[model samples]
Target chain A: MTKMHMVSALNNALDIAMKADDKIVILGEDVGVDGGVFRVTENLQKNYGEQRVIDTPLAEAGIVGCSIGMSLNGLKPIPEIQFSGFSYQAFHHIKQHMARIRQRTNNTMSCPMVLRAPCSGGIRALEHHSESPESFFIHCQGIRVIMPAGPYDAKGLMLAAIKSEDPVIFLEPKKIYRSFKEDVPEEAYEIELDKANVRKQGTDLTMISWGAMTRLCEETIEDLEKENISVEHIDLRTLWPLDINTLSNSVNKTKKCIIVQEATKSCSLSSEISAQINERCVLNLEAPIQRVTSWDLPFPQFALENYFLPNKTRIKNAVKKVLEF
Target chain B: MAQEQIGQFGINHVSILDKEGNVDEKLASGFTKEQLSEMYYYMNLLRKFDEKLFNLQRSGKIGTYAQTKGQEASEIGSGLALSENDWFVPSFRELGVYLTRKVPKNLLVQAWNGDTRALGNPNHSHNLPISIPIGSQCIHATGIAWASQIKQEKDVTIVYFGEGATSEGDFHEAMNFAGVFNLPIVFFCQRNGWSISTPTTKETKSETIAQKAIAYGFKGIQVDGNDVLAVNKVTTQAIEKARSGDGPTLIESITYRMGDHTTSDDSMKYRTQEEINEWENKDPVLRFEKYITNNNILNEQEKTDIHNAIEREIQEAVEQGLSVEKPNPEQMFEDVFAQMPEMLKEQKEELLNEIIQMSEQNNNGGNQ
Candidate 1:
């Protein structure tokens, strides 16, 4: 009903979910009073009271671990990790326990919790603030990982994540928290977490990206068109339990493809997707799938952050390279 | 950001009831006599069931078993501390504790038999599934406690581990989170003096596990774990503190793992028989029996009947748990999702058909 930014959309989604379910709790560091470092949880405590909106001490493992317990105890917990890069501190819970909990307990129990982290680079923030790490979660089976490309996607994906019976990792694009605004509906709606959305249509090439990278892809197409390159764009909202049919159909049409992720270029999630594409559509390929990703280096300081991240120019160059091939 | 420690731990020990069945005026008993007797009876059941399982293992009826014999006081005492709605997150060896919480005896047997489907969740009671990974339960317990407080639920939580589990990173993280947030949790560490072959002397340089709480800004206490009365009293106080919203407490019950670490281990490889004998003399169950008998609380006939009753009950549980039908191979893949995806369904059908064909081929070969 109103034009909201990405963070505002998230706040609205959480507020709506919590208001509907008494068992739902919002937990994380500074999420209660300060409303998160980015204000995504702004005014939640004032509305729900301290019992529902909790500000936990800074420990990623504890946040995720406890959320699992809360979920088992009949509460729907929405946990915040402050930033995506810091999630490495909780790999034990995520890799060993988070997804395996239901399997560990013979499906007698499940971690019906959602972990919210601000992912992807471009905000020019500190080193760890803007890194994308969805691949680690994508590799996990029982758990679902997702990211939103815009305000509408953020609200819809968050609502879906909260409603899911299994544990979910909802990665928010931090750089775009306030960058764009859209008319998010007042009536609650859920965009399926496993379905991918095609942002634009073209036959020359299909550029795939998610999170903040989708915005850059849109910009890249704008410049690529100046040179008369009509490109297709696929925004993958959810990474795990992927909507492969969407990618296959799009790739089948375009033949040429480029995968742009803000995370590192090594054996990342994009590698898995590329392998899947090659296996499924090998005959239709016009060239090898190209990846425009960050280098395999620790996220550098903000001073050198620009070089560590992929920008519009990088995506355009990747498109040019794919087209030339 | 933190508080100061009063003194080093292991120097002070707590006890409430005496060997003569007299309650200490200085230490208050939290529960009535009826509740105390119920807890004592559960401990007796645990002891009898443990003996049965150990015998089963020795006779080749079951696989390796973890005997929770001498540590009954620690497990039962802590188990009784939780209210109906509270959670008891425990490690695998706390069989005595798990029994009190209704962890289906059959499921326990099924899990030990290597059938993953037999594993149950903490839903059996307000407790969690038995955690095999050391010290991992503490973080889960803290999480549940945090959620309870965050959701304004009246339920508190208790977590069980051993002295050796303190070394894990998750343990430190658990304490750090509980301390900072003032979470409602009771941390019970059964200091059984040894973790497998590693002795407490080399576990850590810290004087006492209880004192570790002081470093994290919480109250810590040491109790005579073999003294059933003391374990009950100390656990009650710590659990009550958590229930009242004062936050967590670290309780170190100084006991010994009177038997081998597990049925698969050999204590003789590392420890002396004389030490085991010394601990056997301090058996919590026998001492409590003596305390009650000496006071003329029960005649010899009554004691005999109690033992016979517990044996009969344990035998029934064993028979029932073993009698349950074995899980089907088809059901092994269930519960992963409410609705299995098409790929998993396809894979399951393929595996089942392959199994059928393989069986048919063997039958045909036998006929030929």
Candidate 2:
């Protein structure tokens, strides 16, 4: 095992996959020569040559649409949309073709491609660079949506997403791209899709979150444990095809739950999780489920970003409310 | 400073066969009698199939279908130029291409009837399923060609779209990629005069759709879409150039939409009868039929036999399409993923149990 950050871990994942399969090709804006905007694909073009690692023109729809074509013709293409906010330009291709090709063709043609984008806020970057669009992709059918919080899970999930037969929307939280380091395995490994990780176990309250918010939840759980409140913290590594079984089991044991997310409160993944928990573990619940999320406005600019995002105070307050109820 | 011309480009228009069934003998000499007869047969077959589909929709046997009436030459000529190894990526209105590629007639019927099984296996046939969103398949064709280039394969990819597609950003992006990579692809554009209710003149003011390729650093040519010989000649030359690594070519075939945009449309509301009459005089199928007769490529007896055979084949296809069983509800859960996740499995099971419970309730009520 070696210590690495999220960017290095993701780059290692790409290197390993490309070395194992010649059919794997990476293409996007600035992916070659410059590695990537976040340098997640550094040294890939140098190692794989320009053919396998392409530097395409600045057209998101073309990048995604062409990748769909490449995947259709027997190549496993991983196309990166520069930012999650700009993915809307390619949303037509993603929602219409990439997600439905297999079902539309009755399994005759499947798109085994992965679309990578750096998502969520806290980077203090320009507008459109800090938006969380996981809920948009989770609502789409026939595609897997994944978001990995740390270096270890990033490498494992990236490899699994590359090997998956179905199309995957891999959302990398840019805020933590290089914020911290972890001892990740050197060899290839796969963390199964549609499975959540139990970061810490407790019997008092259950806190569910994903992406960068999971790190905040970890800190909050540390503080709560010191205050004599036991909390079960779960990181939803895969957003779609959710591991509801794990969630229900944890909620049943804790009997109080709080969902934290970076996206707006309306029609987000948190809403879905809250509704599912209410349906499945309502009888076991000791209090009403609380959701701590960003307000239902457009993601604010950098000045108000910290205020807009769910902070530790907000999460602890939600936890207190659920416990007291 | 003095002003000078930076670049000069010219677009060429090709028309070897005329409306009067006369051809420039030298330009048409490359085609054998068999090839000419085959092209004529496909054109006739497409027209017949188109009429039958119209009747089927009228009788409520199938859903709305986009007809391929006057553009038969544009579809069949370019389709026949392709080798089986080459890919045929098409927009929704190329039934003639499917016929040329030997896609089953029953599958075509089923596709129009909204059956999923009609998509067939694209890997086996080297043809993509019809794209409905308009102009999106061009980029796919470029990517396929790019893949072939990367693998150092000689296979070329040919993509078909309509005139209105030229106005789309995807079309321009596809052209740019083909130019930049020098990929082996042919952008076959059918200038079918109308995109639904809107005419081509309103879609773009570029004088001709073929010239758009010049900006992308490639050759663009306009062919009389009603002239099967000209379309065949240009497409053949374009495919050869692509195979030889000469890069992509854009061929604009000029034709008219002889029918409505689809069964759901009424062309009479927007188009004048006189304009329709003018195009009807230059019908592609009639022109090809006359050419075959004038050249002695097919005799009257042979023509009658071909028609009779086509009628029988259409009948069999209709029967086969109609006789297909309704798909099981559980089949919907399949193909969404390579492996059904536990969540989906539970949902499928719940749906099945719900169906069973409803049936059981009905049975108990009947006994009471």
Candidate 3:
């Protein structure tokens, strides 16, 4: 095992996958020479050559639409959007073609490609560079949505997404891209998609989150444990095709739940999970389900980003509210 | 500082046959009798099939249908220029292209009937499904060609769209990518006079859609879309150039819609009878028929035989399409993912149980 950050781990996964499969290609703006804006694909072009690692023009829709075409022609292309905010430019292609090609063609043609984008805030970057838009992709059908919290799962989940037969929206938490390091496997490995990872187990309250928010939840749970409050922390690796079984089991055992997300609360994945928990384990709940998410307002500038994002204080307050209820 | 001109570019127009069936002998030469006859046959077949589909929509047998009444030559002519190894990416309203590519006639019928099975097996067909969203397929074609270029393959990709599609960002992006990569692709735009109610003048202020390619650093030409020979000749040259690594070409085929955009539209609301009459006089099928007769490629008896055969073939396809069994509702849940997730599986089970209970309730009510 090698100690690596999320960026290197993702780059290693792409390298291993490309070396193994000639049909696997990587394409996006600055992906070829510069290795992506976040350097998640560093030196991929040098290793795989320009043919496999392409530097596309500055057009988001073109990158995605071309990836769909490449997928149709027996190539597994991974196209990266510079940031999650810019993905809206390609939303039409994502919603219309990439997500529906298989169902529209009745399984005759399947789009087996992965769209990678750095998402969530905390980097103090420019505007439109740090927005969390996972909810938009989760609402789309015929596509898998995934976000890995750390280096270990980043490598594993990205490999799995590359191998998936269906289109996958792989959202990387750019905030923690290089913030921390973890011991990740050197060789190829795959984490099963559509499953949640149980980070810690307890019985008092269930703490559920994904992506960068999961790291904050971890800190919150640790602090809560010191105060004699046992919390079961779950990191949702795959957002869609959600592992509701794990969530329901945890909520049932704990008899309480609090969901956190970096994205806004309205019509979000947190809302969906909250509704699901109520439907499945409502009778077992000792308290009302709580949600700690960013406000419905647009993601604010860097000066107020910390205030906008859900922090340890907000999460701890929500935990207290659920426990008191 | 002295004034200087950086670049100079010019657009060329190609027309091998006129409305009166008079051919430019030099340009129309070298087409074998079999090839000429096949072109005539497909154009006529497309026209007849289009009429039948229009009738089907009127009789409520199918949904709203787009009629390829007068632009048959533009679609079939370019379609015929493609080799079996090449890819044919189509926008909607390319039924003639599908027919020329030899897509099963019943599959075409099934598509208009709102069935997913109409998208023929991808493993066996090089033609893509008709993209409903305007101009979206251009980037897809560019990518396919890019893939071929990467793999060092000789196959080419040809994408078809209308004049209005040129205004879309995807179209320009695709052209730019094709030019930059020197990918083997053909952008075949049929200037079919109108984009629904909007005319070409409102679509673009440019003198001709063909010149749009020059801005992207490639060659572009305008062709007489009503002249089957000209479209075929121009497309053949472009295909050859692409296969030989000369890069992409944009051919704007000048044609007319000759009918409403689809069954839901009424051209009379926006166009004049005189204009329709003018286009009717330049009908692609009649023009092609006249050319083939003048050149002795097909006699009157052979024309009659081909017409009857196409009529019977279209009728058989319609019957076959109607007779096919409806897809099971469970199929809706199957293709969304290769392996159905637990949530989808549970939902499918719930739907199935609901259906069973509804049928049981009806039976019980009948007994009561």
Candidate 4:
């Protein structure tokens, strides 16, 4: 085991994948000599050469569109869009081509590419840097969307996404890229997608979240445990092919659910999860599925971001409402 | 260091054949009489196929179709320049390119009918499916060339798009990458004057689309797109340069959009008859046929035989395209992933159950 941060785990995964497969390539703006703006790709260009680890011009659409072409031509490209907000430039390629290529070409061709971007808020980043756009991708059919909350799952899920046949959107939580450390394995491994991780098991109420919000949910669960509130905390590692069976099972046991998300409340992944849980575990419900999420308004300036994002107090209140009901 | 004019860059316009069957013997030597005759045959065949598909759309047999009427030379000439091993990336309106690449005619028709199975490009064919969204395929072509370069392969990639695509950010980004990395690729821009309702003059104030490449650090050539010989000549040179590791070149074939953007659009709404009439006199196939007839390269009997054979072939292709069975509706949920995820599997089952119930109801009605 090696102690590493989320960025290091992702870099290590790329190194391992590139060394194993000659077809693997890495490209994005500032991904080469600058080693990405966050240095997540530091020293990779030197190791893999400039051809494989490319520093593209500042064009998100080109970076992604070219990567789709490379993927079509038997190259496993992991194109990085600098931020989730900036990924809108490539959304046309992502939705029109990357997600639909497999279905468009039938089983003849598949886009084995991973579009990596930093997502969610809390870093006090400038506009277009801190945004949780997972719902936009999760809503895109035929694309696998996965976000890792820590280093261990970061390496595993990164490897799994790189190795998947269809296109995968690997949204890395920028808030935790360097926030914490974990003992991640040096060897290559894969944590299966479409599976949820049970961070803590309880029976009073089920708290479901993913990405940065999972950390807040964990903290909220710990704080509520002091009041003998046995809140079950589930981190949904994969958002698209959601592990609803696990969520439904938890909801059946707890009889209540509260979804936490960093994105706006309308048509969010949280809304989908809540609807699914309602469909599966409505008879077992003790209260309505509450959502602790950001407001529907545009993400405000950095100073007001804390208020925009879901906090421990809001999550605790949601859990208390479900338990009290 | 004071900036001084160290060098001069000027765009060269190329045209090997005139509208009245006159040819430049010096530049026309590269093509054999037989090859020149074949180009005419293919160009005629493409027109016939396009006409048939337009009729099919009118009859509700297919969806919206993008016609490549006047721009045949720009598509076929550039497509024929690349070797078999090289890659071809096509925008939506490259019917001539698809024919030159030997993509099955039935599949092209099937694609217009909204069937995904029609896009099953043969294995190792190196031909990308038609990109409907304009300018997106340019970057794909650059990346394919970059991959071939990394693998030390001699293959060059050719990407096709219209003059209006130059306004897209993907085009600039692709050209910038090709210039900076020296990737082996060709950007074939058919400047067909109109992009839907907007004219090229409104799209960009630049005098020529070819000059856009100069800003990205490469050579750009303006070719008479209606002249098949000129399009083929420059494209061959560009492909050779790219394959030999000399980097990319942008060829802007100056043509006019003789047809509407697609079946759903009306050219009469945006363009003038005078402009269309001006381009009709410089028809690519007619010019090539004139040259062939003037040189006696293909005798009258041979020309008649080629036309008859192409008509027969088009008839067979139309039959095959119409006869192909429709794809199973359930196939939609099957290929979304390598393995259907649990959620999709449940949804598929739910759909299957509904389909079964509906079919059973139909069977009961038939019995009654």
RMSD of each: 3.8, 1.7, 1.4, 1.9
TM-score of each: 0.89, 0.98, 0.98, 0.97
Question: Could you give the CAPRI-style class of model 4?
Answer: medium
Q: Write the per-residue lDDT of candidate 3 for residues B143-162, one digit (tens) a residue.
A: 89988888888999999999
TM-score of 3: 0.98
Q: Pick the candidate with the highest TM-score.
A: 3
Q: Where's the lowest-lDDT run of ten residues in candidate 2 chain A? A: A99-108
Runs off by more than 4 Å, candidate 1: A226-228, A312-325, B1-12, B16-41, B55-64, B121-125, B150-152, B176-182, B330-332, B338-343, B346-350, B364-368
Worst 10 residues of 1 chain A by lDDT: A121-130
Candidate 2, residues A1-325, lDDT tens digits: the string is: 9999999999999999999999999999999999998998899999999999999999998999899988988899999999999999888888888888888788888889999999999988898888999888888888899999999999999999998999999999998899999999999999988999999999999999999999999888888889999999999999998899999999999999999999889999999999999999999999999999999998888999999999999998998898888
Every model: iRMSD: 2.1, 1.3, 1.2, 1.3
lDDT of 3 by residue, A1-325 (tens): 9999999999999999999999999999999899898899899999989999999889999999899888888889999999989999899899999988888888888889999999989989889888899889878888899999999999999999999999999999898899999999899999999999999999889999999999999888888889999999999999998999999999999999999999999899999999999999989998888999999998888999999999999999999998898
Q: What's model 4's overall lDDT?
A: 0.88
TM-scores for chain A over all candidates = 0.97, 0.99, 0.99, 0.98
Q: If the candidates were sorted by their DockQ against the true structure, best first, what order would they fall in?
A: 3, 2, 4, 1
Better of 1 and 4 by TM-score: 4
Candidate 4, after superposition: displacement of residue A45 in Å? 1.7
Give the per-residue Cα lDDT of candidate 4 at B214. Answer: 92
Taking the true A–B contacts (Cα pairs closer than 8 Å), what share appears in each candidate? 0.56, 0.67, 0.73, 0.70
Residue pairs clashing, model 2: none
Write one digit per residue (lDDT tens) for candidate 4, span A1-325.
9899999999999889999998999999999999999888889999989888998888898899889888877788999999989999999989888888888777787888999998888998998788889999988898999999899999999998888888999998898999889999999999988899998889798888899888778877787889898988899888888899999999999898999998999998988998888889999998999999999989898999998999998888887788778
Q: 3 or 4, which is superior by TM-score?
A: 3
Candidates 2 and 4: which is better by lDDT?
2
